[model samples]
Target: MELLQPGESQATRLHTPKGDVEGVVTCVTPWHFRISVPEDKAALAATWLRDLSDGYVAFDPDPLRRLPGPIVVSDSEAQPVTQATGVPESHLKPYYIGIGSTTDLEPLPAFTWEEREPEQLRRTPLFETHRQMGAKMIPFAGWEMPVWYTSVTEEHLATRQAAGLFDVAHMGVYQAEGPDAGVFLDSVCGNDISALAVGESCYTHFLDPDANVIDDTIVYRRDQDKYLIVVNAANDDKDWAWLNAVRDGKVRIDSQRPWARAFGRRVILRNLRDPKEGPDMRVDIALQGPKSRDILLALGCDAETRKRVLALKRTELCEATIGGFDLVVSRTGYTGEKMAFELFVHPERAVDLWNALLKVGEPMGLKPCGLGARDSLRTEAGLPLYGHELAGPFNLGVGEAGFGSFVKTYKPWFIGREAFLAREKQRQTVVVRFRFTEKGVRMAHLGDPVLDRKGRTIGFVTSCAIDSEGFLTGQAWVDLKYAEEGTPLYIFQGKPQSLGKSPAELKTGDRLLLPTPAVVLSRFPR
Candidate 1:
């Protein structure tokens, strides 16, 4: 038997009472294998199961099927096993599996995760800190991140009632500068960049030629010739590639990307995350809640900076010094809360700044939150998540969003201008707001059918959750004919079934649409 790594191959032979057999590792995840054994050697591989350990066990490839020949039973245990280990395979220490035979339908899956241990995942600067704080780190966008600190419900309420701090360093923060900064941004981004004066930020989208969103981002105008574009972490690479393609095609700038990629002769771009190698070495942090402003105030800013921060309006960014360290602060957030801000600081001082905020804001009931809380908070506010509610290079008519309010047809030119206009004229669908009418109805999920009174599907749920603010809440994209305010609909719930031994045996019943009133879907339902 061979203990094969994912995408790698190996072969080994097993020696037993009857004789010896050869096996090859076929797959790693489900522990698939192909073996060749003489009739006499088959039983020897099956009965060698005394030292059954965790990742080290004997393989019984066909446990449930009638065995080629298996007449060996030990009184110790009768449970069938899947993972095979021991003997001649000991030489392959780090990853070793011995050849074996027998009948077992479902073996415990232990080796799959062994191949993907925690150390194998990418770690952020705060990886150790998160583990110390008891944060349950999970894989997100290729980074090991804390999905929740304590509880999503608790963290959500903390941010709503008091304050919650979030590590947003994983976002893609790019800086574009030089004489053609505004021109480059205006031409590639969907929003009107000329209107973005210094010290201000705006919600915008990077659109493809077809006007569909490459990513929803916040563009901050640092100066007339400089801007900082913050994009979702998951789309960092795609956004970088798209930006280079867009700028290179323009052939007007020649800035460096390693320092910050060059789009033309004067324009240069650099990533904030790579501060050591780039211009900005700032870690992103989000402080949000009803008391968020108070916490920022308590960060020990000077009177002048305090006054400036107090005077700033929403979507505004300003430079300020806190505890003698300079920070870039933005009065914007995703949770739909009034007192929220996104702050950036030097990586060397992130832990200090984080500690300062928690210490200063502890009296105000501030808590360090995780992505789970951030998601729930955003969902409660009826915001659209990239993959779930908004994705692809969408036209004006796509999805359940009408961010066309941010689109500028009056601008000189930009990506997707013509395509967006054409799609706008051919608009055929609309997104709507909805809540379950019947008590005890479960929250809807993506692709769950949305039916009308006659039980015909007119749309499907885009985002749904049994929210803390209210009961079953969700969003759906509907046919223009059925996309009206106060329109009633139903969300189908799929039937349940047991886990299966193989892919073909997995049974899942179709969702049954229940007559529950779900309505109010005009983008912003009100």
Candidate 2:
């Protein structure tokens, strides 16, 4: 091949009793030739070459060149590829590069390099409002936000009893608007994106090629050509990059971290993206509890706004004016509670709206809550949190809300469709909610393992909580062998050293597996 010059194309077929394989030599280097094969056959050629300690190439310039071109049957010890593959000859085929064939088989660029820098923390519109209320502010998802006002227990029970206000402006808000919006969404996203009608929303998973989750997010349909993607705050940058890569170049996307001004009922989003990391105009506040609807109704916004907010169904969105601020309001919440609404507002007016809700909601025992209670409430509802319960296979993070149903199979093409299609046949192991029989408030930590009768590790706890009834509840992913509804399991102090990250993901830690008896609850919580 050293004698061959660059751009001197030659059709070459290798036949060392390895059946017939073909490719076009586009470039010749001193030591090797750059062979371009059909993409489908590319992997085969690469693998075959790696196994060849000795082989000969046959140049076939014949247009009529076909399979079995020069089959020199081998009586030697080393078998041909056909025999090595243990497959029939019918599967082997010849290669043909049409006259003046043009192809691009260049290697992709190397891994990207990024210089690390300390992130500057941010504050919300209600930064002072939280301070005045004596709320404890802490670093959460790169934002200085309240964890609790008085105590997590107080806020948790209040959200259960009456109403509570939560500042959630730090979450990422992104929009993708174009004529091919639905098509772009369906191809790159998991679950049903076009299934949603205008004014409705659905929870979906972003996935990699292996059908592993990138992030679990909510997709809202605002119009026929407009859609809103709400992602976790910490995942804003990564999620944006993933979406852009998979759009198949339909549309260009640029986004930055979202921060806002006013604390309103719903956020009416302006353009949320910028070239640089800057303050975002959209802000969100969650009003939750049994009396949440009543408190929203009592707000001094227009009558139509009140009617619209009241008319929204679960996972529904509508435009409403709270205290005369035009915004989008959605009936959604992480905590499993009735009548909860997340309001998106501008940054400046957030203080006015936050004060108004506290004033009007005083009669309903409404109080401003923080992150501590948010975590507790969501755990009680069996919702998985990032870096805890939810992780897909490869990213080593991102959890599924549940299984199978949310994954759409009808889509002909998607990033992870092939992998998921194959996964459908396998017995699925999903997360389950379990609890200790004894009434106690003590709960398991993130890495605690769940064991079987013989003390073999089956799964580990993802999320845990002790509800008001003293019911210890949590979620975990157990293998099919010990995943029955009435399966007996025990909680150990730490993970088993023998446990490794397998298909079941059973191995989690390196601590002693001492046992505390527990029972497996529903595979999915009711």
**Best-performing candidate as measured by lDDT:** 1
Note the Cα lDDT for every prediction shown.
0.66, 0.63
- Alpha-carbon RMSD of each model: 25.3, 16.7
Query: On a 0 to 1 TM-score scale, where does candidate 2 land against the true structure?
Result: 0.68
lDDT by residue (1-526, candidate 2, tens digit) is 2224555655565442345566555443322346655555655666555433222432244422222212222222221121122212211111222222322323222112242333777787789888988988888777899998898888888898998889887787777665456655765566677678899988777765566666777788878767878788767766776665433222212111011011111222223534232443566789998998888877767776777777899999987777676667889888888679888776777788888888899898998889988887887777767666656231232323355676666543455655666655574455667777777535677677777898787777777775545576777767666666778888864444643345464555634335677787775456
In lDDT terms, how accurate is model 1? 0.66
Off by over 4 Å in 1: 1-120, 250-265, 392-400, 438-440, 494-516, 521-526
> Hey, what RMSD does candidate 1 come out at?
25.3
Error of 2 at 366 (Å): 1.8
- Error (Å) of candidate 1 at residue 351 is 1.9
lDDT of 1 by residue, 1-526 (tens): 2224445544546554445565433433323333433345445544453332221433433221111122232332222233333424332111113322232222221111011333456666677778899998888876788888888878888999999999887788888887667767876766777777799998888766566667788899887677888888777777876776555543211111111122232457767778454436766889999999999888787789999899879999888887776888899888778789998887777777888898989898999989888887776677777776676223223333656777776553466665666777777776666777755776567767778889787877777765566566777777777766778887675422432245554457634324567776445423
